[model samples]
Structures are given as C-alpha cells and as structure tokens.
Target: MSRVEARPIAEILAEVANAVPDEVIGVEFERARRRGAEVWVYQLKIIAKDGRLLKVEVDAATDRLLVAEED
Candidate 1:
C-alpha cells in the first residue's frame, strides 16, 4: 500500500489559528473513510476567549475545514 502525503501539523494549526479567533486547547488525530478513500483529519478543541468550547475538524490531506461547531 502506498502512503498518502499530508500537510504539516504546524502549518495546519497556523491556518486554523488565523481563521478562528479562539485559542486551541487540544487536538486529536482521526482516520476516516470517505467515498471508499481513506482520509486523515485533525480534530481540534478550542476555548473561546469568552469561555465557549468549540470543535473544529480539518482535512489533513487537503487542508480543508470539514466541521466547526460549538459545544
């Protein structure tokens, strides 16, 4: 099997930090399958300056924002 190349975590985190106006408190790596293709994603837990918890997911291979929700 061939390995897929993913973007650097620092780069991804930098982008996320720029886009979101919150502080990233935690991060999780997740593997999922989509349309028969294996995909890698980064799940982030963020704490808003005002104390709200947020969850964000970004595609590792494409650097695409998959999900962002408040919890």
Candidate 2:
C-alpha cells in the first residue's frame, strides 16, 4: 500500500462540494473511512446558507477524489 499524503480533510470536502453546480453556503464532512486498500470514503452534507441541503459521497485515494450521487 502506498502512503497517501494526509490532506486537511476539510479542504478536500470543500473542493468536492465546490465542484457541484451551485455554490454551497456551508459544507460538512459528515464521515470518512478507508475502503479496502486504495480508497477512502467520505460522506458529506452540503447546506446552502438559505437552507437547501444535500448529501453526497466522496471517495478519495492516491490524490484523487470521486463523488457519488446522492440518490
């Protein structure tokens, strides 16, 4: 297993949430875990300052991130 550089999880979460269509007023990294050997799973909740909320899943590994659909 290669050593993955530890990044500020908050930064990663922000990047993922920012990549979404509209800007989210607030974002949270609800949860995260290692998947097998090469994947890190993250569950995020994005909230628009106005109150719109969305949940998304992000998988990160080897300096890469994959965001999954909510539904």
Candidate 3:
C-alpha cells in the first residue's frame, strides 16, 4: 500500500465541516501537483440558510482549510 500523506483528506474535510456553522452541500477532492508533490485539494461547498455558498480549499497533506472568496 502507498504511504498516506500528512493527513487524510476525509478527516480534514470533516474537521472543517464540523468547524463551520453553515450546512455543507458538497465535498470533492481535486488532483493537483504542488511543490513537486501530488497533493489532494479538497473543495468544500457550504450552503448557508440565507442562500449563500461558501467554498473552501483544504490541503490533504496539511489539513489546512483556507476560506476562499464567497460564491
């Protein structure tokens, strides 16, 4: 089996979703190459009750969730 990266993408997304007060609509893993490493980028779409979409990107290796511009 391949060695898992710094952290699991599912765990990272779960943590971020739990931290958010809004409701999560969708979660997807994006394949991208970063810093010579094949990194998994998690795109989380949160649907607010007020009808707003919140998108965030979480790094699979670092589990760092970064809030992006609202959509």
TM-score of 1: 0.83
Give the candidate order by descending TM-score.
1, 3, 2
- The lDDT leader among the candidates is 1
- Please list the C-alpha lDDT of all candidates, in the order they appear: 0.87, 0.53, 0.74
Best-fitting candidate, scored by TM-score: 1
- Report the C-alpha lDDT of model 1 over 1-71, residue by residue, as the tens digit: 97655788898999997899789989888897766877899999999998999999898988899888997
Superposition error at 59 for model 1 (Å): 0.2
Q: List where candidate 3 sits over 4 angstroms from the true fold.
A: 1-6, 33-38
**How many Å off is the CA of 43 in candidate 1?**
0.3
Best-to-worst order by lDDT is: 1, 3, 2
Between candidates 1 and 3, the TM-score winner: 1
Clashes of each: 0, 0, 0
Model 1 spans > 4 angstroms off: 1-4
Residue pairs with clashing backbones, model 3: none
- For residue 57, model 3's alpha carbon misses the true position, in angstroms, by 0.5
